[model samples]
Every structure is written in C-alpha cells, then in structure tokens.
Target: MEFKWSVPLIILVLVNCDLYSTIGGSTLKNCYLCNTYEPSEPESRSYSSESSELVGILVLKIVHLTLNPNQPSQATAAKIRSCCGGPVSDHFQSDQFEKMFSNRSSLEVEDHEIENKGFLDYQSFITASAFYQPYGFGTTYINQDFFGTKEVAAFLAHVATKISCGNKVVTREQLSRDLCYNKEMNSDLSYCDEHYKNTYPCAPGVAYYDRGALPIYWNYNYGEAGKDLKVDLLNHPEYIEQNATLAFQVAIWRWMTPIKEHQPSAHEVFIGTWTPTKSDNLAKRVSGFGATMNVLYGDLICGHGDNESMKNIISHYLYYLDLMGIDREEAGPHEVLSCAKQVAFNPSISSSP
Candidate 1:
C-alpha cells in the first residue's frame, strides 16, 4: 500500500527548483521531500547543468508548505503553477470514483489501469457527489467526523484506495459530461423512473440528499436509513458522547473490512468511553442501528430492548456479529470482549432507553 509518488517529473522538477530559489541562490538546492536547503551542485549527477543550477542557485528562501505522502501536493507545485488559472493537477483515480456507483469490486485489472492515470480534481469529484468542494470528505474533517456513515466512508475509502493503488476512478471527459440523467436512452421507463426522472447530477444517476450527493446502494438493506439513524442519534447533545463513540466503531468495522480484515483488540481500548450519562438515555433506541445493519447484510437481524439491562446490549451487538460469521477471534478476543464489557457497564446505548 505504498503510494509511489506519481507526480510527473516535469512538475516535480519545476516546483522543486523554484520553491526555494531565494536564499539558496548560487550554492544550494531545496528538496521538497526534505524541506531543507542543500548545496546546489545538483543532488544527483543526472541533472543538466541548468537543472542543477536551478536546484542550487535559487533553492533557498522559497516559502514552503508542509509536504507529506498521502497529502495533496503543494498548491504552488510546478505543475499547478504552470497550469495557473487553468485546471490544477489532480493525483487521484477517476475511474474508481465512477465505479463506486456500481457494486463491482475495484480489484479488476481494468480498474487498476484506470486509477494509475493520475492527476485528479477532487473538488469536481466532490461536486459530482452533490457536495461543494469540501475541505475533505465526510463532514469535511480529517478524522472520524469525515466518515460517519457507511456510504460516505465507503466513498472516501474507495477514493483513497484507488489513489494509493495508482488507478483512475473517473476521467476528465466524464467530468465534463452531464453526470445525471441519460437523455439518449429514454425509450423505456417505470413510474418511479419517470416520476423522479431528473438526472442525478454529480454522482451520475443519483441526486443529492441534504447538501451531499446520494450514495449508491452497496451492501443493500439500510443504505440511507442506516446513515440517518446514526445522524439522528448523535445530534442530541446529551447522547453525543456515547453515540459518537459507537458510531466510530461501526464505521471502522464497515470501512476497514477488506483491508484490515478485522480490527485488533487495541481498537476497543482506544475507542471505549467512560460510562454514559443520564442524558445519554435520550438517544435513539439501538433498534434503528441494528435494523440498519441487518438490512445492509441481509442475513442478520437485530433486536433492541428498551431500558434493557446492560448485559443484553453487550450480547446484542455480539449476537449480530456472530450471525454475520464474524467472531471475537477475528477482531481479537481481547478487543471484542473489551467492547462487550463497556457495553455491559454503559447505561445508555442500550436496547431500552
């Protein structure tokens, strides 16, 4: 899962030289990777004298933004600067983003090649998803807030995976086309189709709900309902603390399944909260959450007890996990058991109020 830097050399070389041209003049070149000014003489012999001079002579004193792998490249990078006022360079997979609407696995060979095409416009992608270009995904936060629901989390995860694997999730041409309704294929139709015939704008065949683009149904079952359930529960200030904790666990389990297999025992320890407060009782019943999970998976059914003992709440989640053929061993007995223990002690987040 190493994301080899796919930025074009032309872009990198240009940005590297100008980014620190002031102070290092005539003596040093700056490395964006190192964020340090180094003697110019060309760090390597392959570079031409001019290239080397560019690297050394004017390499220092360039204002630099923090550069890191997995982060978007500096806005002032050479590629972007060259394209100035034009479209900026994107480094994400375009095809994969398109494929997210379909339930196909992104592991196919074609998908791989598509992702590697490189350079993406994340803002357009976000816009396509019915959201304004966000600071990032989810609720525009860097942490769990960005992945609160299964759909959004899945989309973000898919994009990241696509980028890491060097695949394109969408195409520049596709971005230009109207992504919503298909005007050419209007021969047949049903009531629901004709009723809501307005093409889904950015997400291709899906409309935005609230301010965000609609998510294609992936696992089936709860789709929007599951997301809504969590939203309703967490909105209450009293229930916010405990519900946030549980929501995060649910998201981690859903988002990391293909890669991590199952989270380790440490996850429970890292996420478990102190006992819930009396106000936490105001939260919605677990039935909605459970029912949502059951819908997504189909084979599993979840039941909630109102004002039930903490013991049953612990068993409740475990029961569904077991039904899904997931066991404590996969999640690690220690982690699963720890979560169960927390559930047992918590007064809120139970079946009953």
Candidate 2:
C-alpha cells in the first residue's frame, strides 16, 4: 500500500523577459529538493521500541503527510531524504557538549525530587542526537554546512536557559556561572486543558507541566508529542527527566516543528526559510534568531523592552557560541538577537507581565 503525505506546494513561475529590458528583479529558480538517498544499515543503531515507533511518525511530521506505522516505506524514506538536501555535517562534538553542560552535575538535586534522573551526560546526548538524524532535523537549516553549528548552539542555549537552576542569582557575574540549572522546578497547577480532553485527555495521575530541555506543557502538547514521538508521554510525563536521549529528542522535535498551523518552524525562522509578509514586516518579524524566540515564547518574552527572560536565553546562545569557538560577533545585530521590538507571531492577551 502506498502512503500519501502532504508536502508544501512548490511554486514554479516561468516568465519570458525581453533581452534588452531590466525592469523588475529576475525570478531566480530557488532549488529546494535534493537527490534522494537510502539509510544504510539503519539496524546498526539500537533504538528502543518507543524510539523506533518515532521514525514513522517523525517521517509523517516532516513530510506533512500520512503513512502506515507498521510497514517500512522506501518511497517515504526517499521523499524525506530529498527534503534533507545533502549529507548532514558532523558539526557537533562530544567535548563541546560537555563544556556546554559542565555545570549540570553540580545542580541541586533536591532530596524530595522524585523525578531527578541525574545530570544529562555528554555521551548520552551525543548518542541521542545521532539517533534523531533520520528525523530531518539534523540539517534543518536549508542544507547549509556550518549553519548547522549555529542552529545547534542556538538550540543548546535555549535548552540551558529553560532548565537552568540559576534562577536565584541576580548578578550577571554570578548568573553566568550559574549555568548548571537542569530539571524543571515548577510545582504549580497541572498544565492540562479540559477542552482538549477528547483528543488529549489528562492522564489519570499525570501533570502535563513544563519539563525537559524545551518543555512541552499541557495535555494537548503532550498528547501531540507522544503521538509524533511514539511515546506515551501523557501517562509517562516523568520519562523526560528519566531518559536523557528521549529528553534531547523531544527538545529537537520541538525546535524543528511548528507550534501552530500556517506558520514556519523555529528552525525555519532561524535558517531564513520563512519570509515575512507585509503585516509581519510591519510587526518587525524579520527572519532571524529573535523571530525564532517570538515564535516559541510569543508575548511572554517578546515585545517587552529589555525583558530579563528573553535576554537570559539570548545570553545563553551568545555564550554557547563563544564556547563553541564561533565568534559571538557573528550572531548579528541587536534587532535580530533581541525580540524587544518585534510583535509576537502568536501573541497572547496581556503582553505585560
């Protein structure tokens, strides 16, 4: 049986221009599709049942189409490889990962914290990253070479910021050293939504609160992620902290996918896959790192002048760039690094905190 998936419409416009005229900008054919390649010896990688299930679901998510979960589809694999462009560079290194999370081991492990799975080790994260290469997120930056390094650094910065245990420190000097914050510390209300109960009911004893590197809150989010990731995250919310590989995979998935429909993925925003419309231009939503924040955090972080939360995440990114031996100066202008002037692509009520 052939499984059909929905891919974005490729618009190819042809025009016949006069040889002597140079009126409007010429329509350059932007090449997007790539030559297809098959995964060699995929069985060599040991993925758990949950991780294995994710391959099919992830393919559907990347292709924006539907396919059978049980069968191996060469056709599907070929299409996915085409979207991936060229071979993904081994841009990240284990030592770089260790340096990034060097403080994780020292993070406070509360005696009463039942879900603490200890610090995420560099080897574990590196292994997990390798497992997810098939998800098409490995080279999400429009087939660029070293651009993957920037994306990875930017991604790790958000991961560090969200799970950082450095929230108590006030001084900048103290805060930079406070990078060892891991584990989600919130213990408030459960983030489940009753409206989505039919589709993503709150598991009997689970609280779908923020957890993991890039946390996924609410029953709907957990439900959606669980489906795409082939993990029962709704019922096993604790699985995030329990498994480093799963945690990293979940964060990468969040970074690569879109939060809503008709919008670009955070990866797309960072890699310049998205072009702003007139309204977006008016809102100052340019394609860059700041636009990525606006997409993920919305009004909670963006449009607020010099907000500390937004700055913290940005600081982490720049800091990671420096640590990764990439010039912090290459991060770009303040407008692209800070979302203080840009309107949220998905703004919520009460922009003011």
Q: What's the lDDT for residue 292 in model 1? A: 25
Give lDDT tens digits, candidate 2, residues 272-312.
76778899999988887887788778898999987888888
How close to the true structure is residue 314 of candidate 2, measured as C-alpha lDDT?
Answer: 85
- Native-referenced Cα lDDT, model 2: 0.59
* Cα lDDT, model 2, residue 21: 19
- Model 1 off-target regions past 4 Å? 1-92, 98-125, 134-139, 142-151, 155-353
- Per-model lDDT: 0.25, 0.59
TM-score of each: 0.20, 0.70
**Tens digits of lDDT, candidate 1, 1-353:** 22222224323643542322331122212222212222222223233332212222112211122122222366534332111110111222344344432322223324333321222223333322211111121222212121112224233332233222232324422212211211112223211223223331122333222111111212121122233223322122112122222222223223222111222111111222112245323332122222222222222112232322222223333332333334434323432322211222223232210
lDDT: worst 10-residue window of model 2: 11-20
Q: Which stretches of candidate 2 lie over 4 Å from their true place?
A: 1-89, 107-118, 131-145, 167-183, 186-188, 349-353
